[model samples]
Every structure is written in C-alpha cells, then in structure tokens.
Target: MDTADRLIESTRALLWERGYVGTSPKAILERAGAGQGSMYHHFSGKRDLALAAVRRTAQEMRESAEERLSGPGTALERVAAYLLREREVLKGCPVGGLTQDPDLMADPELRAPVDETFAWLRERIAALLSEARQDGALGPVLDPADTAAAVVAVLQGGYVLARAADSAEPFHRAVGGVLDLLGARVTD
Candidate 1:
C-alpha cells in the first residue's frame, strides 16, 4: 500500500490493539514501516492519523454488518448471521474495543466515529426488527428499541467474556443464547 494507506492501517491496528494511550508515534511508524517524514507528510500528527484510522475502521465495521443485516433473510436470521459470523474473538471488536480507551473517549474527534458507528448499528438493527414485525416474521410483543440494544450489549459483553477467558466459547454461547431468545419470538 501507499504511505498514507499504510499509516492509516497501522494506526487502526495499533489503536485496536494498544488503544490511544498505549500507541506512540514511533510505534506506529515502526509498525507501518514508514518513517516520521512519511507520517507527518500524510497526517498532522498521531491524533490526525488516528482519526483517519478510526474513520476507516468505522466504515469497515458498518460494511461488514450490512453484509449480513441487509442480506435476504428473515430479520432474526440476518441478526443471527451477523452474530455468528466468523471473527477474531480473542482480539475483541476493532470498533467496540475503542470505547474502553479513556484517552480515545476523552477526545471528541477520536470518539465521534466510534459513537456514530454504534448509533448507526443500533438504528439499523431496530429498523430490521421493525420490518420483521411488520412482515409478521417477529412477534408483535418484541420492542425493537430494547431488543436492538440488548443484541448489541450481548455481542460486546460476549467479546469481553471471551477475552477474559481466553476462549471463543463464551462468545458463541452468548450468540446462541440470544438466538434462542429471539427464536422463541420468531413467527411462523
């Protein structure tokens, strides 16, 4: 990749892996295989590069979710697909993990993409649930807003649990539990 691309990608990985507080300009340059001149040429500094990285990560996360959430299927099926999709569970979520970084959260520019990503996800999931109810695929008793939040909570919590245990089983179980709950509400 080009210098700018490499720098952005390196920042994304570093931010995900090390968080903003832990990531340094020197480390980013080392990881990106670029020099200080290249990084400064492309970005004003670490924060600027991190913002670009965050934006790219947010876009990627949205596209990944859209692939399953917008695919042809019942709403629950689509959600299950997203939840069950292959992931590097041990590494945690690139976007969700950023929320844990106090330094990142302290910066409005750095946090905007993370905040926007979740907002978009929740809205999209709620809309999917609403559509499913309208189509008689989901039970009318389900609250789209509450259920949407629950779904996201389970996924993020699952990642935490999995990381703590050093296993992907917790993540799978969480997804399975959610699917079971939703399965009970799926209309014929």
Candidate 2:
C-alpha cells in the first residue's frame, strides 16, 4: 500500500483497539512504521487520518449490510439474514461501536461518519420493517422506529455486555432474544 493507505489502515486498527482518546499520533506512526514526515505529508493531522479510517469502515459496513438486505427474500427473511449474519461479535460493530468513544464524539467532523453510519442503518432497518408491516409479516402493532431501535440496541448492547464479561454469550443471547421477539424460531 501507498503511504496514505498505510497511514489510514494503521489509524483504523489503532482507533479500533485504542479508540480516539486512547490513540496517539506516535502510536499510529509506530504501528505504520512511517516516520513523522511521511504521516504529516499525507494527513492534516490525527483527526484527518481517523476520519478517513472511519469513512472507509462505514462504507465497507454499509456495503456488506446492503448486500444482505438486497438478497432475494421476504422482508423478514432479509431482516433475519442481516441480523444473524456471522460477525466478530466480540470486536463490535466497527461503526456503531465507535459512537461510544468520547473523544471521537467530541470531534464533530470525526464523529460524522459514526453518526451517519448508524442513522443509515436505522433507516434501512425501519424501511425493512415498514415493508414487513405492509406484507403482513410483522404485527401491525409494532412501531417501526421502536422495532428498529430494538434491533440496533441488541447488537450494541450485546457488545457492551459481552465486553464487560469478556465472553460472547451475552451477545449471542441478546441477538437471539431480538430474533425471538421478531417471532422467528431460535436455533440451539
């Protein structure tokens, strides 16, 4: 990879591991094995580098979700596919998980990608729920926004709970619980 590409990828991993507050320019440069001049030559600063990483990760996630949502299926089927798709659950959703970082949230420009990513995901889930409502799949009484929040919440909260316990079981149960609420049969 080129210098800029190397910087961005290093920033992404550092941000993922150390978060915005915990990460430092030195950490990134050290991780990338790029000198100070090489990094400053590419990015305006740490924020610039982190923004690129965030945007790239967000785009990747959106593309992955879109593929699953667009695949041939009923609305419920698509929703299920999107939810139960295998993930590195312990690592958390790259975009969603970043939203909780204080330093990241403090920088409006840097935070934009995280906010936009979740906003798009919620909208997508709500739209799918709307379709499910229209198709008589989900109950009419179910509120689309509430349902969407519940779906995203399970994933986010599961990550938090799992991280707290340092185990994947909470994430599993949370996702399973949401699926159960959606009236799908839960697998063993």
Q: Best TM-score goes to which candidate?
A: 1
Residues 1-188, model 2: lDDT tens digits: 98899889999999889899788999999888899999889888998899999999999999999988888898878888988888887787888778878888898998888888888888899998888888777887888888998898788899889888888899989988888888752222
Q: Give the per-residue lDDT digits (tens) of candidate 1, residues 1-188.
A: 99999999989888877889899999999999998999989899999999999999999999999999989777777988898899999989989999999999999989999999998998899998898889888899989988999999999999999999999999999989988988888777
Q: Cα lDDT of all candidates, in order?
A: 0.92, 0.86
Give the top-scoring candidate (lDDT): 1
Global CA lDDT computed for model 1:
0.92
Error of 2 at 106 (Å): 0.9
**Distance from true location, Cα of 184 in model 1, Å:** 0.6
lDDT, residue 157, candidate 1: 96
Q: TM-scores for all candidates?
A: 0.95, 0.91
Q: Which ranges of candidate 1 are over 4 A from the true structure?
A: none
